[model samples]
Each structure stands twice: as structure tokens, then as C-alpha cells.
Target: MAAVPLSLQVGERKFTTTKATLSKSGFFSALLAGPWEGDLLMDGSYFIDADPDIFDFVLKYLRHGILPLFYDKVKGHDYRLYLAVLEREHILGHFASPFHKISIIRKRIDEYGFILIWEARYFQVESLEKWIHDKTYLKAIKSTHRASEVDRIQDVSRSFSSELDVEYHTSWKTEKIYICPRRIFVHRGNPEACGRQCKQAQGTAEPEYEEELTVKALAIEKETTFNFEICMDDDR
Candidate 1:
């Protein structure tokens, strides 16, 4: 009910933050929603078996909602270590090829940038994931030197069309729970079903009208308010 101070032990390193801040991450929110014997440590801190170095970036995202731009480098931060962490967490998948050439269009992205986006998605940070997608996805595509302007545009459009489920006569749908790059979209009412009753719906679709919405709807059904009052229960 209150802002609980949280100490996280990663390997030999210890990091501290408030439960409210940690709740920004869906992973941490679920982990802290109730008591768990596996995560608790004798030192009154939650033990997270992850690399503390890479987790520093994760904490920054939770505390400040920091979304780094493509190609932007953090001073004193090694990108290679970040990659290693992703590999260890299985965020990079079986191979690094999928991340390097993202999307079915095979658009190449900066490995570091893709890693950051993947990390946000992995943590289930909806806002941050959408921010990175909206702010950087196209820019990265545009800056790619492998393709010509027209080719890049066509490829990008086709790539996004498939990802966002673009349809000729139906309303395009935005993902309610998952976040994907170049996939944030406004959900206009189903044109094919407009002004029609549910029974008279077009094709096999139900006549359902929905308005344009952002990815914020991803967390709309969840309680996000965090009490700022500090909880002093050390035993917790």
C-alpha cells in the first residue's frame, strides 16, 4: 500500500530503489505483487540472478523513463556487455541475425539500438517500448545505407503493413498486451462494419465500433498508481 524500499542483489552487487519505481516494469510488478520464496534473500533484498552492469540501464528506465536514441552512446557504458547480457537472457534469440536484420523486410538496424528496444520489450515497459518504436524505427530505416530511397520506403511500408496487420476493408488492430517496433497505431473504427448491427456485420466480423487509441491502452486495465508513502518494514 505504501512505497516500499527495495534492495536488489545481482551477483555480488546490490542496487536499491523503491517498489513504486520497480513497478514500472511488468516483470518486477508481478514479482513484487506478492511474496515469493525463490526471489527473497536472507539480507532482506530480492535476489535477481542477472548482470548488475546491464541492469543499471534497466533501473534508469524504471526511475526516469529514459529512452536512448539510435546510435547514441552512453558514456562509460560498454555496448558489448549489453549484448552479452541480452544473449544470456535469450533476448537475442538463437542467433544475432534476427536482431541485426529486423522485420521480414530485412531492414538492418544498429545492433545497440535493437538491443535497447528488445530490452524494453523484454521488461514489458510499454511506454518506453512505444517511445523507442515511434521515435526511432523509421529514422533507423531511413539512415540505412544498404537501400535506395524508394526501395527503403516500399520495404518499410510493407514491413509495417504486415506487423500492424493492415487490412483492405477491416479496422487495423493494435496489440493490447504486446509491444513491437513500428507497430504502434491508431485504431480507427471498423469501416467495413460501420453503421451496421452486430448481426449484420460485414463478412464474418462482428459489428464492433472502436476509436483510435494509443499503446497507453496496453496498461489501461491494470492499476499503475504507486503510493509514495515510504514503507519501513525491513522484514518485507
Candidate 2:
């Protein structure tokens, strides 16, 4: 007598299967092993395994919630492949990548829950210091403080910004591009801690202050590059 196939239901949908055979082997072994038990459900339908690799890929994504680096090879080392996998796996709400346009990434993140962005340089001590000094002095004058207090605050802000800039530049040279997930819950309460954690997670060192600041500044500059473009064809 032949054995009956295993059956499972996820939400309102049901799946019945006899067994799955694994042909191509790699990180997707467990997902192709059969008769695999349990029904994987997302969005409303019971997810099905048609092509075992794609199915394994989807299952791995559903279970681990991340696209493996191998899949990213499809996009010529770009994040687009990763993005596609995220969409397929329904796990796009967990990453951010700055390499893609911010507006598009933001939209995807808002609608899908997360997006991936390549880490870019995002800070400049001079600009931040200037803002801080102006704000600090303006606050002192409004509070009826003496001119000396205003000057002192300005001096402190300038010095701090300068020191921070130095540290930022030094660090930037030693670090790699940082990648982070877009989901805040992944870090639990401290999104600021993402930088450190990402470096550690990627087996890299925390950048020195100068490098971090330089990268931050660079990111800001890159974002505003379009605004700085001159129109050569403008009517004189």
C-alpha cells in the first residue's frame, strides 16, 4: 500500500505534498528536505513550492527574514537583486539601502515596512558646528546673559565641532561602507546604536570619530549635489 501524502493548512489555505527532492545544494538544504512539515502562510495564501530553489529561497527568507548574499549576485553586486528577493519573500520591510534613491526607498519602506540603503557619508563638523554656535549664542542673548556668556558658548561650540571633524576624517579612512536594516525594532530601542552593531555584525571595527563624521558629511553633500549643479544652458 502506498503512503498517504502529508497535508497542512496555513490560515484559510491548504497545501498537500508527498515529498520534496533537493537537486542543487547550498544554503537551501533544509527548506528542500521532505516531507517538510508545517504550512508557511503570508498575506492570505498558503505559500507553495514550485521550483525548489525559489521555494527554498522563499522559505529561507520567511524563516530567517533575510536574503542571502548569493542572491544579490544577480544584480551585478547591486542591491536591486536583494530588493527583488525582499519583495518575493514578503520581507522587504526590514532593510534600508542608500545606494538607491532615497525617495523611492522611503516609499517602499513606508508601504512595505522596510527598505535597504547603502551607508553614505553623512556628517560635516563645520556645518554642524556653525549651526550649533548660532543656536547657542542666540539662546544666550534671549536669556539676558552677559556678552561674555554668549562668546563663551560660541567658542565652545566651535572647538567641539573642530575636534569632532578631526576625529571624523581620521576614522573615515579606516572603515568600510556600513549597511543597516531599516526596521527600528531590529535594534530594540536605540537606533543610534545601529552603526556600532552593524559594524560588529559585519565583522568590522567601529570607525573613529573623524571617519564617521566625514562619512556623514559626505552623505549630506551627495544628497544636495543636484541643488549645486549649474545650468550651463541658462539664458544670460
Candidate 3:
């Protein structure tokens, strides 16, 4: 007997595809490999509860094996906001370049001569000389105590606005970018044992979301070049 092509409903939008395409995802392949012993929906289509607009992007990859050209079709003010949906779908990295913008930023930083530090925090500067050595688990010192505006979850890492600048004696500066402090989940460990004691000092708070860092780099400069690394972040 010939196999049935799988029919799916993602966020009210329906689509049909062969087993070969859907199986590209280990999650789906494993699901279909077994029996349909349980009752499916009356409509006979498997429903995937996900962001409808975002799934369109995933569908592109599943059907064509390429990133969606309509990256902006999803509703959101933030440019990289769609990435969170991709991460949940579990196929975030199955592409030629998952973080296209981040790749660009990294390339430009490399073209110059600055060393890129991967996980920069807001309180990790040289000021805490004594606390640094004696403390068993000093919370990653953030470089500063001020409010930072790298709000978009993705931009939190990719925004180069306030990051440590490469000191190559080059006069040109990149566009005003926000710096992404390596965010540490302060409450992850025991509160009392924390060297900074930030958790015990403050009460529990609401949940917060994280973004995958992404950016493209380069600001034209005055006849000078510097090499650098962008210890950037990725969802994968």
C-alpha cells in the first residue's frame, strides 16, 4: 500500500507534505515512525500549536531546504524577534547561516584588529580586585550599574553600541550600538553562597526572556584597520 502524505495544521494555517520532508526534523520523524494508536482531531489533520506567521518560515525550509525570503512577514517590531520561534521549533540551526546578521558583524570585527571577548558582563571590570580573588563565586561582574537599552532579545548580544571597543588607535567608531552584557541567571544557584549576594539582597522577580544575538558590522574609518573578535551569542 502507498503511504499517506502527512497533512498538518500550524496555527490555523494548513499544509501538506511528504514523510521525507517532515522527517528532516528528528522530532517529527520520531513521532511518525510509531503507530497512531491515539485519536487524532476530527478534521484528520495534525495540529501544531505554534505562531502561524513564524511557521511559514519553517515551512520554507521543510519544503525547499532554504531560509525564507520573507523574513519580515512575521508580525513584530524587533528585527530578530522571529528567531525565538525558530528555536522552539527545534530547527534553528538547520540552515546555511542561522544568524545572518551576526555573521556579518563578526566578519567586520575580524577585518579589523581588536580582540573580541565572548562573554562580557556589566560588573566584571578591574575595580573588584579583592572580591575577585577571595570570592568563590562572584556573580559575573557587570561592567556597569546603569540601565542598558539593548532590549530586543536578539540584540542583547548583537548590539555593539556599548561593548568594549577595540583599542587599535583607530579614530573611526561604529554606529552608536548597545552593548550586550553576558546576562547571568542570578537565581540559578543558591542565593546565600553567591559572592555578590545580589539574589538574597533582592526579592524574587518575574520571569524574563532571552534573545539570540545577531548583527552585521563595520563603520567606515579614516584609513586605518583593526582586527577583532565579537564573542557574540547564538540560539543554537
| Reference-based lDDT, each prediction | 0.45, 0.31, 0.38
lDDT of 2: 0.31
Task: TM-score each candidate.
Answer: 0.38, 0.17, 0.33
Q: Which rank order by lDDT, best down to worst?
A: 1, 3, 2
Alpha-carbon shift of residue 54 in model 2 (angstroms): 3.6
Candidate 2 lDDT, tens digit per residue, 102-183? 2222335564355544221111112222323233222221111112222122233333221122111112333333334433
Better of 1 and 3 by lDDT: 1
**What stretches of model 2 exceed 4 Å from their correct place?**
1-53, 61-67, 71-80, 89-236
Worst 10 residues of 3 by lDDT: 118-127
lDDT for 26 in candidate 1 is 66
Cα lDDT of model 1 by residue, 177-197, tens digit:
322122223323324223334
| Cα lDDT of model 3 by residue, 68-136, tens digit | 221221231222322233234323233333222122111123433343221111111111112222331
Stretch of 10 with least lDDT, candidate 1: 217-226
What's the lDDT of the predicted structure labeled candidate 1? 0.45
For model 3, the local distance difference test gives 0.38
